[model samples]
Target: MRYTVVLSYAFTPAWLSLSRDERNAMEEQYIQPVFAKYADQVAARFFDAEAFHAQHTDFALLETEDLQAYYHLVEELRDTPLISRQYLTFTDIRIGVEGGYRTFEVLTRARE
Candidate 1:
């Protein structure tokens, strides 16, 4: 089954205070590689909630058939400075909203 993962996160003040060069290097040397590794199996998208008057700072969508890749990505990301330094605080993980009729079917059946 295909999976849709929505990861919502907020950035720490320290993260926002980083130099542009520092931020760029982190994205290039760390973050992007994580996505690149799973690029073929998953399509990743980023949304900046800060511009939209939202609670969270950022959002990411990951769609993949290979679930293990998702797990690995999370594990790897957890150790990055973005996470370890508490820069990117993960808020939630939402799964399977885009599961077509199966989504409705499952929710309907569970309502019994």
Candidate 2:
């Protein structure tokens, strides 16, 4: 099975002021490790966030054999400063063939 994941970040107004490199550094330092930890179950094809917008969105395509393991990985990394809201969307291509994208939204608050 394989999964394509997209992550979006809903950023606060203050967050938008940061430079692209600043935002990228945050992910590279904090978020990337979380994903790398689960590299065996999920492989990231793309990881990027828009730094000039009030709402920053990070998108990624992941290939995974175990859905549960992927879910666990998402759950673990949902609250980091690099992201506000982590949305995991899964698409099942077949019983064994499943892939989806995830969107992580970086926001000011946890619920928003």
Off by over 4 Å in 2: 6-13, 47-58, 84-112
State the lDDT of candidate 2 residue by residue for 1-112, as single tens digits: 3555554444454556778888788878777888888988887676555564334444556667788877877776766764443222222222234422222233334458
Q: For candidate 2, give the lDDT.
A: 0.59
**Which is the leading candidate under lDDT?**
1
lDDT per residue (tens digit) for residues 1-112 in model 1: 7889998988878988999899899989889998898899888999888887456888999998888889999998997888888878887789884667897788899998
Off by over 4 Å in 1: 100-112
For model 1 the TM-score comes to 0.83
| TM-score of every prediction relative to native | 0.83, 0.55
lDDT of every model, 2 decimals: 0.87, 0.59
Q: Give all candidate RMSDs, comma-separated.
A: 4.1, 13.8
Stretch of 10 with least lDDT, candidate 2: 86-95
